[model samples]
Target: MAEKGKLHIVMFPWLAFGHMIPYLELAKLIAQKGHKISLVSTPRNIDRLPKLPPNLTPSIDFVKLPLPHVGNLPENAEATIDVPFDKVKYLKIAYDGLKEPITHFLKTSSPDWVFYDFVPFWLGSIAAELNISRAFFSIFTAPILSFFGPVPVLKGTQEDRTKLEDFTVRPKWVPFETTVVFRLFEIKRVFNSFTGDDDDVPDTYRAGAGIEDCEVLVVRGCSEFEPEWLKLLEEIHGKPVIPVGQLPTTVFDGGDDDTDDAWRGMKEWLDKQVKGSVVYVAFGSEAKPSQAELTEIALGLELSGLPFFWVLRKQRGSADTELIDLPEGFEERTKDRGWVCTSWAPQLKILSHDSVGGFLTHSGWSSVVEAIQFERALILLTFLADQGLNARVLEEKKMAYSIPRNETDGSFTRNTVAESLSLVMVGEEGKVYREKVKEMRELFVGRDRQDGYVDNLLGYLRSHRRLKLEDQSNGGQRN
Candidate 1:
């Protein structure tokens, strides 16, 4: 603990912005509670962080490390939102190479604990070896985390991977009926490649990623939103699983004056539409759909005939294509019925707007929570890891509908896209899903009224700090 009654802590996050931002928010909250946080990242990302809160900035320390040489990633390419996929690979290499420095910092600085995102599998073990307690922080909601526990390992040839009927059928152990079972096989294939025999990375670097045992597992469980998976994680890990509810305060508070302007603009636009008449569409920061798919989605939105708002990134292409070109006059055609915001928007604010009837989303946990918190109906279109599982949960809960993508190739055709969007926007089934979402949203808001997530998280942190201090005192006396 610091002399001024602050607990000294360190935070290490994976290279991705989505993963890093939430963890940084948590750190900021802890700092508000009189804790000093040392955040570690590649030099590029550290340089890119929006300006920090004045008070928190001076209290928190930033540690920047070099990226390992991989390929043609430019030196200035650290914090740019448009980092290429190959560059992301290089950043991972850089993150991997910093194991020694990280371990050294853990050993020397000896903070109360360290927090890590997905990176080295051996992170927990390394922290243990350094005699430091560590926490595994996952940005995923509980249900998504629950699915990753022990499951029957499928042993089959590559050809067997394609049978949708075989894949959709549930494994005997998994307790849900899903049309999405085939999707799990796809994830398994990716996992296998990362852990396969031909891979140069050690098994320790691949399998389990050292998360087998952790002192504590921290989850973004804002709103008591994911109960089933939360219970499952407790059962699987046999450790304290802490759901630090949403830490709402940001390091960059969007400046003092302009913050209200974005909120006011969205609210004004939303007020003009009927209740549940507009669709909000946004792929998260890291997800970039192909130009063809982007066009297909746009056409689908045009077909749906609902008022909508789509948030698009300025540049498209990460690990996929170099440029994403939209159809001519696409923006103009939709201008009366829709608005497209460049770069980021006030996502939470938009979701909370009355005119914002439903969300056409990528099923990111953060976005999912926001939708639930505001009680907006959802149309799920997932593109990456665990998002499929999240989409399944929302669909199962009757709070959302998913676009049926081709199982073999993971493509969303126009018909499937149009129908799914309608299901959330105007269909009878869409109404039912919307009502269910309303119910869940009501439940979440009621819970928030009684016990807001931010306050709960702060209380947990204080309790955790006290528990650690007691444990240390007991150990000292015994020694």
Candidate 2:
């Protein structure tokens, strides 16, 4: 007979790198425990997935689903990285179209558990129809989930939908008073996206609907970082809220970028810098800064008088443009101490190096977790989405300093950026933040600590079996 508790898990993540990476990590952990893992994605996304270890190759298999063709979506554009932000919605529409193909796969795979991302409101119904289990995997931190609260309040028709300021004050579901909400402009940017142009239904609706339907929340966070908030979510959701740790990351050596001229150039310069004195800067894959913001950040780095390495992704739509306009002669002036790369660099290798001391980042969750794993102090300049909230959590822990922006205009100046970066890398405050993050690194990177949370989640999933007969009686439909 087959092993009783040995389960088959299907992981379906959204088309964003931030979402897919964590889900892949979780799948790896579960597969390490001898459970089977089937990772489902569109063609290109599966091809681009992080290289699985040789051992895992035996336990996991990729199940490709063809993205449905949609008007205005570029051919082969199946993920957020494949299109610009404005075109991302078209990708979402195409993602929703995958329901049929995914359903077909589920019916055939018939896995014991299906772990899906924040989108895909229809998957719960599919799971119910198949009489298989469903779990929602949140790639966001506990604070982001807590800030949104439970499904009822966020999905309620009674709430106002126009002005972001209405919901930006604080989440309605938090029983205790707290100052955990987005700043005005951050709210404005998200609100602009929340109410889409055509508005058949926003992805937020899918998120909330999926939340209301899921059996549990398998989060990429740990109690050490967010105990109070995690507890609050369990109470509010009336279902299990499992913290899966930050999910340990393995650093890549001699990665795709290692041989590129920009990578070699940065490495040669970085090798000469004093240990723990250089700061590495790179926004995540999707955060494309505007020309004005880029100019300000460039000026700020120049004036900081510290050795730094900045990765400037090629300008959008114009792949060949090497560098955006920096202050005239700035590169020549700081050539010895400041090195800028116009291509992707090995961020994991750079951060893990002894010479790197701080990270100037856009505060994406995956980047934050990786920086913490390497004990690097953070200088957060949040750009979009949940980044503002993630920055606040680090600031609350005294582990990072966020750049100050104008309260009304939400614009930050070159001086403020310089000051924040300096304070985090060289000032007395930098020392305190560095020490605090170092302490956190031990807890964050410990294999035993991470495995403990995984063991708990695995045990729960093993014990919580539902009656297939009862589900069949209910027409085997997802609610």
Candidate 3:
């Protein structure tokens, strides 16, 4: 060890871009406090990580671990993007193989703490072996976990939760008024996407183990937005839960939109529109829309007759599917008022643009935080799992309007999509939502507030420096 006062932390997030980026952000933030961060991941995922600041580069090290090749898993397919949705659990199986390599690194590195993702529930044992403490870096917000609840619910230890429809209704622990649960069709879509059916072998069981085994639950949450949800987590897990404010709340204006070629075209498009007039649409890297859904979304934008910036993604396995899904002559007709992009756009930069006033999102937690951070009014198009619950939270908080889809089956029409987009972007109902977005943006993701949460977390880590191997009996306890 270099010194007694310094902290050495190892971070390992799940392979998904959504999960990994947050862990990277948190690692960067923690490094700024003069702590060393050993961020571990497969080489492919590490390459995909967002750029880290030059000043923090020396303190944050990438601990590359090779992904083991498994049968049926495509060569070099180490992340969620590399495989179809059904093959994700195989990625998880490959991830579990890292325990041995990671444990070896921990043995040599002697890091004080390990901050882990939901999938590596076994890390607790590894940390314990190294006389190191571990915290689960929950990229999902408190509400998602609070609503997903404990082992009994997740493992279907109880009879009711085993079925798909059971989760459509609120979990018993959640407040019905603000409860955010999956829809029935959403439930079917989620379970069907997964390859496994046994609750004992599902990802939930693995995720909950980390929560139960960790010293504490560190979440990307802030009291200003989800105090009740935070409390619910504490009650359910009976462990210390720290809301490390929706992170990366730095005072950043993004690259010079006017000068940078990366954003030049997008900036030019926005400049052509009035301030607070464009709806920035993205559904994340995952959540590829089907042909029918893509058509509806495309026609929805056509029907809305508003300025928009839509990021269209090609469906996996087919390279030209983006062009195939668009309604005939749709792009040509909407060219003046809308822009369709097939590649990745700098999401935060687009959200921060003056002309971008609203967002049409999948309501994934990362997307949710990004929208709220920029004070963008939301038109939620929640597609799966926690996203449905996340949409409900925004609706209950009045922070955004959840699009009304078919109640029994989650199918939505182009008209409703147009109506929801119009309402969030230009209609009278959107006005109040925009106003609330501003208030929440200031309260939840304010730069100073997020900075303070990092400081608090660092302080918590420093307090654990004196912990020794003999404290095994109290390993799960958090201060």
Which candidate leads in TM-score?
2
lDDT of 2 by residue, 159-181 (tens): 54457776567665677666667
What TM-score would each prediction reach against the true structure?
A: 0.80, 0.93, 0.92
Q: Quote model 2's TM-score.
A: 0.93
Which stretch of 10 consecutive residues in model 2 shows the poorest summed lDDT?
314-323
lDDT score of residue 172 within candidate 1: 40
Total clashes, candidate 3?
0
TM accuracy, model 3: 0.92
How does residue 22 of candidate 3 score in lDDT? 82
Where model 2 places Cα greater than 4 Å from the true spot, the runs are: 160-162, 251-264, 316-325, 466-479
Clash totals for all candidate models: 4, 1, 0
Cα-based lDDT for every prediction: 0.67, 0.80, 0.79
Model 1 TM-score, all chains together: 0.80
Candidate 3: misplaced stretches above 4 Å?
156-160, 192-195, 198-200, 249-262, 317-324, 467-479
Worst 10 residues of 1 by lDDT: 151-160
Sort every candidate by lDDT, greatest first: 2, 3, 1
Residue 209 error for model 1, in Å? 3.0
